[model samples]
Target: MRKILIITGNYGEGHKQAANALYKVIQLRQLNYEPIIIDFMEVTHPLLNPISHYIFINGIKMFPSIYGFFYRKTRAANSMSEILNKINNLGVSRLLKTIKEVEPSVIVSTFPLAAGAVSRLKEHGYIDVPTVTVITDHTYHSSWIHDNTDRYIISSEYVKEDLQSLGVPKEKIAVTGIPIRPEFCHNLSVDPLRTKHGINPSIPVVLIMGGGVGIIGDGSTTIRALENLPKKVQIIVVCGYNDKLKKQLSRELSNSKHEVILLGHVDYIHELMAISDMLITKPGGLTTSEAVASELPMLLFKPLPGQEQDNAKLLTDLGVAFQAKNTKEMIEVLSFSLFTPEILNKMRGNAKKIHRKWAAFEALDVIDEVQNATSSHGTPMEMNS
Candidate 1:
């Protein structure tokens, strides 16, 4: 079996989520491809990986504005990103060593740092595997740009145009949306999912997510706001991988006026989305794409200032999502549209209009073409049609 190396990191779960989605696609398609997903940080700096991840998680969680500030400052500064890229590329030697060991026929990067290291490998003439980067955010960043990258799988056509403006050849970029779990691509009836989860099938459902690490906090006020609406709604909050938040939310919402189901670290987000009328959450790329695939309208909470802000703008622009900058605005938006079937219908329609459910399969097709055209001597491959 040919191996496809997927290099990712744990900065946020978005990169890892993208990697897992592509891996699942390879598995289900049974395409004679072995998808090897590796945490680049673990391979490059094992001892420091966990510590660094802790710092990042806490830093962003405690002070998102600070994180967003840096994200904005460096987002478009390609020339100014050189030092940062060089520091990331310092792990190129270790990464290249892993490449030799894995002997992958193709290399795909879901993390920008991993992409940097792999691109450095190709530029230094150390490796030539078909290299692809699945940009995990809605916005383009200089960290994702690198020479020697064969193809870039991006979120949307607008992002493609932006990359083109940055001088990346049109042929070098492909708009496959963002790869999401294959389960999210399936069509399932909401009534059945509601029954399975023991939720009332007749009532309109609201699903809330805080990204993978549960960035949504207690969300007590959001629930109170929802309850204030005249319409009766059932709310399910998925507190991903955040046990403390889950416990706190559960205790706090034990007597919530609106029916509330607070959960922790669930693998079945597809089912949740299938039943939800509107998803109130932070707009991470993977989650938003999954929501789109499920044709669920969104109520994005105050997004952090980086790619999330970008994601919110794009979704709101497409009319699939509504944004709330704070508690008051969140309640107001829900109150305005929550009881209106016509408005909700419009949101769902807009979601379907931009839903790219087959992004993983499309990306796989490109990767297959790249691999088939590649030379045995590890040289660049002309894309085979």
Candidate 2:
């Protein structure tokens, strides 16, 4: 059986989640193709990935400004990014060995570092496999563009132009929405979900996602703010893996006015999303894509300084979401926009224009087209590969 190797990393769940979502699509689309997901850093240096994951999660929390500085510094074509990429290439030898062992018919990268490594392998004639990069974020970054990459599956049209400005051929880029879980892509009924979840139809539902690691913030300020709202509302807090946060919210909200549902990490996020009227999140690419797919309006809580900020800006610009500068502003935005059904409906409609329900399947289509072209031409695939 032919195999498709998907490379990802554990810096955050977004890369790994994107890889898993595509793996699901590959499974459904190709009966003969076996999809495998590997943590690239584990393959390169087994001991390093855990340390790296710890540093990444804590870095944002401990020293956000410094982390933000590097994010901006490496966002465009710059010497700093060049130096980092050069440093990263030290692992390419191990990466090439791993690739050879897998012997995948097609390879897709959900992490930029892995993409760079694979590009080096192809450049050195170590492998001739077709390589595609699925960019998990909506923003443009210089590191993802490479001379040898066959195709780019991006989420935004402007990102496609950004790639073109960096000299990538237009045909090499396709503006397919970021891949999400197959469950979110399925058609869902909000009223039925609300009833099943025991959500009151008359009360507006607000969902606060603490992200995969449940680090949105201490629930004190947000909880207090939401409790003070005069309107009757229901708040659903998904604290992901932060057991402490979940317990704190449950204790603090026990006597709260609003109907509160506190959930720990769950596989049924799609179900929670279907029942809610609005999402309060950090605007991670995967979360935002899921929100759009569910037709849920977004209220982006205080976004971090890098890609989260960019993702929030894109959503606000498209009118699907609004960004709040702080807790005060977030409450105010909710008071004004959340109460108005007209504005909420309009935002949902805007989200519809940008949301591609078949993004994973679209990615599969691109891979198939690339393989067919390679078979017919017997050469390195051209644009649109």
Candidate 3:
């Protein structure tokens, strides 16, 4: 069997979710491949692991504005290549040693850091495996489009254009959309899901989420806005791992006439999406993709800086969603649209039109091509940009 290594990290759920989707597609196809998914921080350097985790979490917490500023600046800077090169030199030796032991025939990286590490290894002749990067966000960051990568599976054509503007070869970019779990691909009947959730079919259902961390800016205010909406709408708020927020919401919404359900870290978001009339969320790549898969339109709440902001713009531009920067605007938008069945149906249609459900299969096909070429040569595949 051929060995394919998938590298991801826990910086956010998008990378891990994308990697899992590709893994499922490969398994379902029975492609004669052994896929191993590794979180690079777990295997490469133990001492640096915690530091990296802290930097991701605390950086967002303490200096989100500064982080966002630098993130956007890096995307437009000509010196980004030099900066990546320096970071690559510092980390590539440890990563190369680890890859040498695994001896993967092909590599798929979901995180830019891992992609950069593998690119450096290939550049230095430490590994010859063909490396494909699946960009986990709608926005194209310079870190994601490395010189040594063979192909990039991006979320949209906008991202492809962004890469081309940065001088990446057009052939090297594929707009496969973001890969999502196979369960999300199934066509679920909304009536049954609504029945299961005990939501009234007559009432519009709103599914609210704040990615994996469950903390959005002004979440309390958002909840307050929901309370003031038409009482006929039922609300399901997923506070992932944010127990305090869940409790606060539970307490505040205790006697509300609307059927408000508060959840903490659910494994069945697809079911929720199926039953929802619209999703109120931050436009994380995975969350938006999942919403599209379920044919649910989005009303973007407070989007975080950097990639999410770009994601929001892409969705809004596509006419599949609207953005609300404050509680008053969110309520105004929801109030006017929640009861408009025709408008809601059109948004759902737009979502289905934009969703690429076969993205996982397309990604798997690329992997198979790489494996076949490598096996024919009796050597690890050499990547060409």
TM-score list, all predictions: 0.94, 0.94, 0.93
The clash tally of candidate 2 reads 0
Give a tens-digit lDDT track for model 2, residues 260-322: 988888888899988888999888888899899888999988788888888889889999999
Q: List the residue pairs that clash in candidate 1.
A: none
1 versus 2: better lDDT goes to: 1
Over 1-385, each residue of candidate 3 has an lDDT whose tens digit, in order, gives 7778999988888899899899988889897788889887776656788888878876785777887887877876458656854754564555666566677788999988898888877776767788899998888887787888988898888888888998999888878889998888779887877878899888888889987777666566678667778656799999997888898888888888788899999889999988888899888898898888788888998777889899999898887888998888888899888889888888888887889878888888876775666653223334332
Model 2 root-mean-square deviation: 3.8
Clashes of each: 0, 0, 0
lDDT of each: 0.84, 0.83, 0.82
Instruction: Give the better candidate number (2 or 3) by TM-score.
Output: 2
The predicted structure with the larger lDDT, 1 or 3, is: 1
| Index of the highest-TM-score prediction | 1
TM-score of 3: 0.93
Candidate 1, residues 51-116: lDDT per residue as tens digits? Answer: 989999888768989988888778875555777886776556667778888889989999999988
Could you give the C-alpha RMSD of every candidate to the true structure, in order shown?
A: 3.9, 3.8, 3.2
Candidate 3, lDDT over the whole model: 0.82
